[model samples]
Target: MYYAILAYHEEAAVESWTKEEDAALMTELLEINDRLVHEKSLGPAARLGSTQRAVTLRGKGAGMITDGPFAETKEQLLGFYVVDFPTLEAAVEAARDLRRVNPTAVYEIRPISLYVPGTPLTARDED
Candidate 1:
């Protein structure tokens, strides 16, 4: 199975979204999910809230626990999608679909690593 992560930020008109707008967007995503399901390509998807409600923890022994993100960023991670696709082309297509609805926002596509337990690290990607 392959997975991709899709995220957006402040560019979305979330604050201006009305009930009707929310319904329409949900409908659009539902349609996409339907297509994926038909092709047996669906996995997990989620939409997250703003980072204003975030909490952060720091330090190792008896460290500080703070109420908010660890770092300040203009754009916060808005959501993610994990889908099973035949190839990277399919994953890019999914990202394109997302970008259509959120024109001003950005979508990042990344593959997940499936590392086995008790295995030494080979190469780690920078966060």
Candidate 2:
């Protein structure tokens, strides 16, 4: 099976939802989660805290560490899901369904890779 990373990016900054709307949205998102569970492809899904709480690391000579995201960008990592599917088509289909449920968010479909024991392929080799 293949793994897909479903990500989102908001076009503009917005306030948190109201209590009533938040409840309704939760119910709808739960339904989507149910669908994934039914398909037997939902591995792990969760919403992350704001990027302000993030601590990013980068490698330098002698192992140096950095703080915060590598660089500030308009897009932030709101949340993610690790889904296992039989094919890229199936993964993209799931992403489409998710987009339908939350039309305001932009969905980025990325394929996850596995590392083999010997003769591992580098990113350039895969390309």
Candidate 3:
């Protein structure tokens, strides 16, 4: 089965990291990512951009588009990973590995009921 691992962290705290600090952490994470790739346990993963540039569309009809993430929680969704694991324990283990490297972040794991590999993202307008 495939699982979605959503990564969350305090946006402000993450933003405060020095370039070298961030790069070092990413390098470590990428190392683990590479191992998972070789094991064929990893699928697509992405590092989300800052919330300052985010937008939310609400409602079922002509949804209102608003600037920035509006969640009032302390942590913000920072990134995500899609991986195939045989059991929930296996998925949790993968998340644990990620947490070990980035102690401050939180990982939310959920079984994916439906997923489509969607077309490669192309053209977008810049305002």
> Which candidate number would show the highest lDDT if scored against the true structure?
3
Kindly report which residue pairs in candidate 1 clash with one another. none
Candidate 1, residues 13-124, lDDT tens digits: the string is: 6756898987888798778778877878767778886666777778999888788674465666777878777677788888788678666667787867545579985575
- Clashes (backbone N, CA, C under 3 Å), per candidate, total 0, 0, 0
lDDT of 2 by residue, 1-127 (tens): 6565556654235236677775776688778789889988887788766666677665776665555565465666677777778777888888887777676766666667645579767673231
Please list the residue runs of candidate 1 whose C-alpha ends up more than 4 Å from where it truly belongs after superposition: 70-72, 114-127
Candidate 3: clashing residue pairs, number: 0
Per-model lDDT: 0.72, 0.68, 0.90
- Give the per-residue lDDT digits (tens) of candidate 3, residues 42-100: 99999999999999899888999999878879999999999988888999999999999
Give the Cα-based TM-score of candidate 3 against the true structure.
Answer: 0.88
Worst 10 residues of 2 by lDDT: 6-15
Stretches of candidate 2 off by over 4 Å are: 11-15, 61-67, 70-72, 114-127
Minimal lDDT window, size 10, model 1:
3-12
Tell me how candidate 1 scores on lDDT: 0.72
Candidate 2 versus the native: TM-score?
A: 0.72
